[model samples]
Target chain A: MDATPVPETTATPDTECHTTHGYISDKARYLARLKRIEGQARGIHRMVDEEQYCIDILTQISALTSALRNVGLGLLDDHLKHCVVDAAQLGGEDAEAKIKEASDAIARLVRS
Target chain B: MDATPVPETTATPDTECHTTHGYISDKARYLARLKRIEGQARGIHRMVDEEQYCIDILTQISALTSALRNVGLGLLDDHLKHCVVDAAQLGGEDAEAKIKEASDAIARLVRS
Candidate 1:
């Protein structure tokens, strides 16, 4: 066998696989959501400090979770639209790997 | 001052900051959700390949995003319940760092 190792990574993103999904496009929106989440977290901390009722704290937690969820959904949308489709178009190990990787990410997220 | 730097990281998790939240507790449930998400993604892929109507594809996309959002919510719940609370109790740089880290995570998730 030849001594040279096979090339695994391409020199540039192949076609639609720019790798950067919609991050640039959605940056402002995402940052705003995170700022809101941060405030929510801090507010929850205050509630606990003041010994607020349990149910009230839980309700706030629920809202915080919902906000975070919306953010995740936005990112996932971008990943599917750009990364997955681009990789799929390439139709090789990269394509297969992206598909599997996406599913694995979902699994990890679920269990996180 | 001695050449050695300050001991930034604790030898073990300080008090409640076990670093793990509800992942272990809800592992099975998360996996089930991911499996459903994977199916949803694949179904959407098939619809696109078969040239389904635009609205139908959009609906699937929305559903897939929502499924992913739910996973994020579950994880965030666990983090707040365990990791965040644990860190807050410690009441020091470590506590501050964890709180910041969680917010940063939310930011990153938004921009992902």
Candidate 2:
């Protein structure tokens, strides 16, 4: 509603100033891995276009999937070490939310 | 070695004549999917390059991984329904080898 007062606890410029992703420190490395992953994807498409052996195509798919899984695991690790840990130290609803979010991400990764 | 007689059981032009991949029938569909996957991979790389949120990037990675898994599963299904079945009908060393190869591929998919 237009009459509703803004929550004092809501994030503001001051609080948001320090916010940076956990992966920021390793951004270059992540970028490079992602670049390679893109190339792998392109290679798979090329192989399929060429009508190469099915098993060989599957092998490439497995490799690309592994590469993605590794990157996801690495990002999860970073998130836990930085974002989740920081939130845990603060100890509140945000911390609980962060943990739940992380758990969901893990489940997605495992199922995928 | 040059003087050794060629084994009659070895695959010859007649035996190789009928060899074709299981996915040949669905080649167009698979190509389309792989093309989309390649684009997804490129998009993820761009997200990283642009410093998008870590969790958001992770979400994209999960989606891409799932896409690859589905493709792998589909290809495996085709192989079992076609190549493996054909080999199985022959009922000999080749059949056994085909089964073993499929099992190995399944293991790789699960591990990946």
Q: lDDT: which candidate is best?
A: 2
Against the true structure, candidate 1 reaches a TM-score of 0.43
Clashing pairs in model 1?
Answer: none
The C-alpha stretches of model 2 lying farther than 4 A from their native spots are: A1-18, B1-18
Per-residue lDDT of candidate 2, residues B1-112 (tens digit): 1221211222222222136778889999998888778777777777767766666677778888998999999998988888888888987877877777778778889999
Give iRMSD, candidate 2: 13.2
Give the native contact fraction of candidate 1.
0.00
Tens-digit lDDT string for candidate 2 (A14-112): 222135778889999988888788777777777767766666677778888998999999988988888788878887777777777778778888888
DockQ of 2: 0.27
In angstroms, the error of model 1 at B72 is 14
Candidate lDDT scores, in order, read 0.52, 0.74
